[model samples]
Target: MDNMFVLGIMVVGAFLIQSALGFFQIKHFGNEYNELKAEGRVAIGKRAGKLTSGTIIMFLLDDEGVIVRGKKLQGTTILARFKPYDKFKGKYIGAITAEDSEMIAEIKITRNTVMNAVNNYKMFINGEAIPEKGSPFAELVKKIKNI
Candidate 1:
């Protein structure tokens, strides 16, 4: 009983730490996002790797649709935090070719994520509803809703 009690306490303590760290990480992301939003239009893209590291990319755009700045966050843990990115700065959005994407992206996943951001910006300019890409569970829920 004593051992089990100690284990339970440890688990609870770990959970609390994780939750607190996650909250702070989210706050950091929000502050960065809001800062960019204040400067200009912001386009965001995300890749969720269920078992692997995930990535999120945000681009700050000018009125002419040029990328003014960028930020990226990637990791599997809450420790992941947004960092300044400038690869696409001064470049126009929605005009990256496959070759360009390959050259610019540090990895394949980042390449796809950047493309998603470009598409997001394009759709927003056209006044189209942003299409969502969700988990398998979310798809199942949508299917059930339609029925």
Candidate 2:
């Protein structure tokens, strides 16, 4: 086989594998989000990681802004799965304060992400902008534009 042809084949294989993995990741998020939605409104926060692991948090909130359940996923690889994040469960989103210790479990979600969730929920209640994905690409673009 020609060397260039072999390289092309390898690249295609990699792309296909990546796409399949991406699909699985989306499905995983969808399944969990739907489950949480079934219970109550879901508030989400995200932290995009460049060299480190990215983090995403989903909180199931009651109509009164109390957290009923939570999930967090943090990883650099496709194998990362959402884990139960019960730290703030049963706490009111408004009541969770800076005084609360920054305790995160094995998922490695940062306190900043939790604060983002709080801000997002507040914005939601106030009918402001909806929470959006903190994509690294968009951040990079913003940085470049600011420069």
Candidate 3:
């Protein structure tokens, strides 16, 4: 019947359009991944000769015995070494260490406490711990709102 034929054609057309959209989405994600990798490499290079670790929750940058958070990370661990990837040559961005079991609990606790403080807007920035003026994040928000 003509109705059946038209329905079949419509179904096939819809399938093809969905397939194309999925393909484009994958391509876009791949491009974004590559860009992030490049930026990560650059950041690492600038901080080379320094010990660094990357986890799902945060990035640790250890330079001259000082440890600081470089990026927001999930899991915490001391990095054993770096492995160079073929795609990212000279970029020792990949960690070769097993996850630190001991630090896992601590990291989670810290993350939760920090999240709570942030959510409650109870974190301090400068000398004072007031609700508004003491938080750098609040200042940033105010500046953004003004802009």
Candidate 4:
């Protein structure tokens, strides 16, 4: 009975420590984000990938799709949920300020079936096919290109 009581105390202690850590993380990053917003900077895109050590790397892209400005934060995680944007390296995504650089909140363009079809068509035609004007896919492509 004594051993079980001790185990319960230890478990509760661990949970409390975890809760404190999470609270601190939010306080720190939230302040940083608010400061950036006040300055009128936006984040265009976010990319997170693996680092050599246990540390994960995250980058914030500006409007021109450049990784010039971002808050660099280090966190311990075995694997990051973010996947690398492989479609095009250095693609032009329009003017994102530093305020848009929150690690937890990012706009991700999910590829749907229509997007896949368009990509497959592009590949088949050797990348030379004009999407029909006023088509939904064409509008989507335009928006992405403008981003």
TM-score of each: 0.84, 0.86, 0.30, 0.40
How far residue 102's Cα lies from its native spot in candidate 1, in Å, is 5.4
For TM-score, candidate 1 versus 2, the one ahead is 2
Per-residue error for 15 in candidate 3, Å, reads 0.2
Off by over 4 Å in 2: 102-109, 131-138
Cα lDDT tens digits for candidate 3, 1-147? 999999999999989987887577447534534544544321211111113332221223232212232332222233222322222122222321123332243444433432332223222222444333335567689899999
Best by lDDT: 1
- Prediction 4 global C-alpha lDDT: 0.41
| Candidates in descending lDDT order | 1, 2, 4, 3
RMSD of each: 2.9, 2.4, 17.9, 15.3
Runs in model 4 with CA error above 4 Å? 44-68, 77-147
Candidate 2, residue 118: Cα displacement in angstroms equals: 0.8
Residue pairs with backbone atoms closer than 3 Å in model 1 (clashes): none
Candidate lDDT values, in order? 0.87, 0.84, 0.36, 0.41
- Residue pair clashes in candidate 3: 56-74, 57-72, 57-73, 57-74, 57-75, 58-72, 58-73, 58-74
Residue 101 alpha-carbon offset, candidate 1, angstroms: 5.4
- Model 2, C-alpha of 25: deviation from truth (Å): 0.5
lDDT assessment of candidate 2: 0.84
Writing each residue's lDDT as its tens digit, candidate 4 over 1-147 gives 999999999999989988887677667656666755565433322223224222212233344334433443433442223233323223322322223333124323221221322243334346565433355567789899999
Give a tens-digit lDDT track for model 2, residues 80-105.
Answer: 89999888988999776555764444
TM-score of 1: 0.84
